[model samples]
Target: MRLLIADDHALILDMLQNFLEQEKDMEIVAANDMQDAISAVSAQPGFDLALLDYDMPGMDKLDGLRRFMENNSAPPVVILSGHAARDVAQRAVSMGARGFLPKSMPAQSLLHAIRFMALGEKYVPVDFLFSSDQADASPAPDGPSATALTARELDVLKALCDGKTNKEIARDLGLREPTIKLHVKTLYRRLGASNRTQAVMIARSWGIY
Candidate 1:
């Protein structure tokens, strides 16, 4: 995959470029800011994916995103930020972004999200899509707040809601089947459930589904 990574922070740029290029099929072109990213696209014009720092210089929030997406030659884009609120992520998708991702996401998840969104599938963070109701995992007085779940656990729970098998979820999230089993176990413990059906039931009752 050819990637264009744009961030004002040189450290972030280096970090992403170094990590992504470790994949033999991946190549990266780094840019410091929005304008630089636009210029890079003009020069190469064929990046398989572009991950843009949502608050980087010249982004002007979503305006820069709008401009970038309007470009006919632009590759698929996903917004990455230290603080992307639910509304903003929703709005970015409404404005044609493939997804909104958090910078703090585990590197492996980010890689999976990068590939998932690049394939023209939307990859919004599960929490972002449900935060209005579960920001604190707020639920009935007797139940665990879905908020008690980690983002990755929420991801696993959501996959369960979709009725996907452990292997399928593992493949979707770029994790091993054993790691997925571990996540399922963690989800069961966190949600106080013993099986996938009960887990999904509890999650849905809490508005996590």
Candidate 2:
């Protein structure tokens, strides 16, 4: 996969480049700021995905993300930030970001989220999506039910709420990774969710733990 990564921090850029390069099929294109990112996109089109730092230069707030999307609408763009604020993530999603990834995420999870976004899926950290503030403010729907989900599916949903990945869930439940994926697909269909983040929100609204 061809990726365009824009971050002002040289150290971060180096770290990401080194780690992502370990993926045999991945190619890393680095940019120092939003302007650099735009120029890179122009010079090298057809990037599979773009990971933009939330606070990069020339991008006050989400302007960089907007500009990048306007320039290259084909590749999925993701916002990467150290801030874990729910509003920031929500805003990025609203501004057409395919994913919002916290800088604090584990390397494996970050890689997984990237791959997930490449598959035309939206991604947000499960904990960030269901933060304590949102949970407290969210009103429970009357007569809500989780009847749409089977027993195993409910178990998977709970694991998701706890921020477990497919591999981890498979290990914990003594099931194969493919089986867990099938359960996740079923959960998405039953909950009418487009991605894992949306499914978690729907599950929360229904008072499903």
Candidate 3:
């Protein structure tokens, strides 16, 4: 398989390069940032897959993933994110990423994800895909439900999921901090979360991000 790997950290880039190089059938192209990744992919066509980082400096994950798909729709994309949340993983999958793996996972797991995603199968932690409903016998939904938040609230929630502070979110969405706070308060009440971290976790389960 010919793969394009994009990440910002030099150490990680080297580690991945070394590890994947061991696979005699795999040819790897590496890039340090979003722009470099874009150029590399464009310059080297017919890549079988792309292993992308969700949070890279100046790289918009969704946008970059879309661009990559626009060019190469046959080969699936797999996302590697340091941020661990079901919602982010779901979002990446919804956006055409065949697999989503957290950086905290072992290298073997990463290899497994790559192998599975190359086959056009979904890869997510099993726990994230199943929920127990012991009392009702009905299986819980795949993740948290987004029905609790309004359209605007969802926009707010999405910004929050990206690790943006309230002030930063307000500026990005062209709203006042007070307005953002009001929405946050309402979101917390709806999700039954008392803090930003909790809210993010719940929202992630619901795939709101």
Q: Write the per-residue lDDT of candidate 1 for residues 107-161, one digit (tens) a residue.
A: 9878777776665566675544554553443333344667556577789899999
Each model's lDDT comes to 0.80, 0.80, 0.72
For model 3, residues 54-85, the per-residue Cα lDDT tens digits are: 88764575777777677643357888777545
Clashes of each: 2, 0, 3
Name the weakest run of 10 consecutive residues (lDDT summed) in model 1: 134-143
Q: Model 3, residue 89: displacement in angstroms?
A: 0.6
Evaluated at residue 148, the lDDT of candidate 2 is: 36
Q: Which stretches of candidate 1 lie over 4 Å from their true place?
A: 131-209
Which regions of candidate 3 fall more than 4 Å away from where they truly are? 72-74, 128-209
Per-residue alpha-carbon lDDT of candidate 2 for residues 1-209, written as tens digits (9 for 90 to 100): 99999999999999999999999989999999999988888988889999999888887888767777888433788989886477778888988889899898889878877876776667776555554555332433333248534477789999998889999999998877866886687577557688989888887887766
What root-mean-square deviation over C-alphas does model 1 reach? 6.6
Residue 109's lDDT within candidate 2 is 73
